[model samples]
Structure formats: C-alpha cells, structure tokens
Target: MICSSSSSSSRLGWRGAVVVVAALVACRHGQRPMPAPFKLAVFPVQNASGGTAPIRPLTEALDAALGARGLEVVPRGNLDAVLAQHRMRFTGGVDRPMAKVLREELGVDAMLVPTLEQHVADAPPKIAMGVRLVGTGERPVVLWADAVARSGNDAPGLLARGLVTSSGELDRTVVAEVARRVEAYVSKGAAGDSCGDAGRFQPRRVFRAPVLDDVGRRSIAVLPFINDTPRRSASDVILGQFVAQLARSGSFEVLDPGFVREELLGHRIVLEGGVSVDNAMALLSLLNADLVLSGYVRQYVGGQGAPRVEFTAYVLDRRTQELVWSSSSLGEGNDGVFFFGAGRVHTASALSCRMVRGVVDHIVGRRGPLGPAD
Candidate 1:
C-alpha cells in the first residue's frame, strides 16, 4: 500500500499541484464579469491649429483626465498599436472597419476624437478645439460633441485678474470641462444642454427650406466641404463644426465622416466641384442616409484680429437628390459684441461652431431670430 501511494504522489508532485492552483485562479479571474460593456478609446489629438502646438502633452492630459473621471479608457499604447497595424490614420471620423477592429479586437466601446482647430500664443493664449464622442456600433454615430473657442483675455475679470496666460494651463482647463461632459454622458447617459443659437454667433441668413423641417431623426451624412480658403484644411475644421452641431442637435443621427469617407473611397466617388446630384445619389445608396450636407468654405481665418468664418451649406434628399435646404452663412468674432468686449469669440473654430449651430437650429426650427445671448 505504501509503495502504491508513493508512486501516485510522485506523479502529481508539488509542482503539478501549484500549476493546478494557478490555473484555477486564472479561470476564476477570467470568469469575473465586466462592470460594463462600454470602454472608451481616445484617438490621438489631431493638430488642425494650422501651426505647431503640443499634441502629445494634450493627448496625455486628456487621457489622464478621463481616467481620473472613473471611465474605463483603453490604454493609448493599445489603440496606437491597432491604428498602426491597420494603417488607419483618418481622423475625420471612425470608419466602420476601424470601428469593428476597435470593438472586436481591442474591446473599445466608444471613441473620443479631439481636434485643435486654432491656437495662438498671444499675451493671453487663444485656443479653439472641437471634441466629439462617436459610438462604435454598426452605424458610427456621434453621441456627444462640444466645441470651445476661447481666449484667456475673453474672460478677464476686474483689473485683468483672471487672465489665462499659459496655453498648457488653458488646454487642461478646457479639456477638463469636456471630460466632465463626456463622463456625465457615460455614467448618466445625459449630455450637457445644447448651445443652439444661444450666443451672437449666428448665421447671417438661413433661407429657402423645402424639406428641411420634415427630416427629423433622419440619418444625415456631411461630406467634406471644399477648402477654398487659404487656411490649410479650413474645410475640415468647418466640417467638424457642422458635425458637432448636427450631432448636438439630437435631430439627426449624423453619420461619422470617417465612415462616409471610407464609403466614398470604396465606391471611387469624387466631389470635383461640389456634390452633384449624381454624387449625392451614389452616397445616398451607399450610406443609406436620408440627406447629404455639402458646403464650400470660402473664408475661415482667425488671428490677432476678429476671427471670420464664411461658408455655404446645402442639404439634398437621398432618394430624389433634390435640394432641401440651401443657405449661406457668414460671421465675425465681434459680430454683436457691443459692450467692453463682453460677448466676443476669439477663435475660428468656436465661431464656426456657433455659426453652424445657428444654421442647424434654424433647419430644425428651434432657434429664435438673430440676436445676442438669447
């Protein structure tokens, strides 16, 4: 009996026992359920400031800020590795394939795409940025979006006591506000109040709507605007503003531009001059969107002086490719600032957002007449 027992114990020695225990522990850990199905992946900050600005620092700060908010964020290294593996560098929006990759491969639920539109190192630094959260599902949709066009001096209190001097400091401040909004939507599923036609930043004229009011809750695709302005990628900056506004309106499930871009590429579609009816129809069939929003960015410039943004936007029905709404909008930073610089915008990105929101509001019939801080 002793000989038989000794042989059995030798076969399953201490090392085997330890290995069995470790395997059981790992299995237990693997069985533990995840708190939620949603995990956020933040894309690297895109530098659309048209100048050299610190991108890495802002990206790291934003990632850290989101993590501090208790949201599960996929590590930056992991997302970047995936991006490199797939060679996915488009920042306009998350294409469907990229979304699938992030969702299945990396387990990323949503995406936060931030673009620095304008930045200037003045006495009081001015920065304008647009942040958007796009849900990574079958249809990539913008869940929550916000834009900040701010100059430190825009809010200086008595005796210039509250001036923001450093761009880095201002970056964190703006980013924190945005992160708070993102976390709110993530935890409570409620975004901040929409700022539609609230400020002096409004389109000068919004006219001629045939089928605009009827297109509620419909899916819309905003194509890239023609960058006629000298500012590099001005069209992209304004397109982002429209995307942010349209998403914020809660009136339409604005398709992610990256997804739209991917479709356009696959179909070999081109917008030579502007989106023709044929182009719109092709996009309509491909994207299954109710409307297509296309535009031309004539002037989008901001610097030492008042920022100015001018553009024309038109929406066409997907089935008929008939014009639904076509309007031209133009605004300046000091459009209605009458007081001692009380309500003035400092960056083109913010100004464009304001102008675009006004147009979106008018289309949805939610805005009041042109005014200041309504």
Candidate 2:
C-alpha cells in the first residue's frame, strides 16, 4: 500500500520520482490479521486516464503478477462468461450482485479492480493507477485500497541513467509496485497509510459544523457527484477517491459504490442538483449507512498544462438528519511547488486525490473550521 507521488521512480516525469519511490516504499503499512488464502480475480482494467490508452497489457500484467504472488488466478474466459451471462459491464467497481456471482459462479474470494487515472505515454511517460481489493460476500467490502502515480524522468542522476525512456517500462514499474503491496497484504498482513496522513495534500480551506461529535455516525455512503465539469468521468473519479480515503482510514464503513449505484438506479433516485434530505434518508435506510456524502464538482481540467480540480463536499447524518460536515476544495498540479518541481503534482487524478483525501480528513478528523449548519 505504498501511495507514491507523480515523480515516483522504479529505477521515473516526476521531479524526484526516484527519491520518492525509495522513500515512500519504506512507509510501513498497518498490520491486520492474515487473510485466508483464496482465489483472486483481476477485472479488466478501466481506461479513464484520458486518451485511448491500451489497457489489455496492463490487465495482463496484473494477472501475471498476482499469480506470481502464489494465489490462484481465475482465467479471463471464466470472468467473461459470467459477465456475459449477467449482461453486466462492471470493470471499475463491483456491486453486491456482481460479487455474489463471482463468488458462486467462479469461486472467487476477492476481486481486484484497477483504473488508470492518468497516462502520458510519450517520452518521460507518466501514469497514475488506483487499485482496490474487494472481498466477495453479502456485500462487496474493500479490504485494501492504494494508488501509485509516477513519471519516467523523476531522478536523472549522473549521465541521466535513472530516466525511464520506455513507456512500457514505466507501466510495469507502477503496476508491479502496486501488485507487490497487494502481496504484502496477503502475506505479511500489512497495510499502507491513510489519506489524512498525507500532510502536504491538506485542503485549502474547510468549514465543519459545530455539531456534537457522535460515534454512532461512522458508516458512510458517497453518492455520485454533481459533475458540472466537461469531463464525463470526473464525478466518478472523485467519488472513488472519497470512498477509498474513507475505507483506508479504518474509521468508517464505506458502502460499496456498486451497491450504491444499484440502489440509486433501483429507487430511481436522480441527483440532479444535490442529495435531497428525503433522498438522503432513503439512502440511509436502503444502504444501512449512517451518513450520506454528496458533492458538486465545479471544475475538473486535466491533460496539457497544469491540471486543475475544484470541488465541494458535505456529509449528512442519517440519525439526526443534520448536515454534520462540509468543505470546499480546489487544487492545481503546481499548487505547492515552490522550487524545481520539488513537490509539484501532475495529472488531474493526483490533484483530485489530494483534494478528496483532505475533505475526508476534515469529515473524520474534525480539523477544519467550525460553524452552524446551513
């Protein structure tokens, strides 16, 4: 669960990717009970990284790497057959029904969902990948989630030897790094850092309502964001980031996004502007969640020059029906870089990660401005 920066290097765009990889790789993950070894299925890699990046090779590499981790790898044919039978196209996240099918039909214990958030295949290649291991059961539960974003020119070193010239090599470096952490989880029962601890990524500003802290409001569900941006999947990306941060914090039970999507569809809950208090209550009951998180993505601009991301999020208590927490955040790829790209972030995904992570921290850690609810 090593969450590296855009400059992370295996040999690494990134300003100091080489140094980052070495340092972040040493960040020890928290300990958990050793999970019983079970068959794992790697879903087809989803390409939302902008442009038409070929994902088949990436998916193949994950399957091979997981197999090398000593776990049984379910064949692609078996997974495709199940998808065809159900007429489902869930490549990003698994819902409860899909997880049930995978468990009963293919005898899989866990599902690995991977999404490519950023990719610049040209020289000085760049990539940002997010992965989550979901255990199959009554509900699709996230066992672990982590992301690795890196560049090929992180550390040039003497004679520029450390520069990664091959995009293929960069791809494998990131994929292998992520998979290695998965192996670490299955073998040593160690997990990585939570989003709140990523010090530099703290929110630009936050406003928390002066509500009494209650332990009862722990479980949460992040509804689909209201995407005002031009990008079609910006909402999805931010939603996933919020969910990942909540799950990794080990503080709240995050409802599986797939289940949330299914319920929203089943109930015909259309989130045109924001989550209505009534709709929030319905979600609380239907998903058995303590809180519902909703948001609006004002702007999400990626690719080309410095990527920019801006969004606002809020949390509602199911029991009290009160707006417990809320925050507005904005970020740029070069938000905090003061020197020589020392801490410069690249890609919209990386920027959004920091933004979403910060918002999650405010909601759980209660470290933002305090005021009355709107």
* Model 1 lDDT tens row, 1-374: 01001111111233323433443455457642212334789988888888888889888888988999988999988888888999988765788888778877887667889888888887678877688877676667676677766788877888889988988788888778777877776664454643436466666656655556554326789999998988887888878888888776666767888889999999999897888888898898898888889899999888778888899998888755588787788888888789987778777777787788878877767422211111
Give stretches of model 1 more than 4 Å off. 1-37, 193-198, 215-217, 366-374
Q: Which stretches of candidate 2 lie over 4 Å from their true place?
A: 1-35, 193-196, 210-212, 366-374
lDDT of 1 at 331: 88
Cα deviation at 296, candidate 1, in Å, is 0.9
- What TM-score does structure 1 among the candidates reach? 0.84
Determine which window of 10 residues in candidate 2 has minimal summed lDDT. 4-13
Whole-model lDDT per candidate: 0.74, 0.72
Say what the RMSD of model 1 is.
13.9
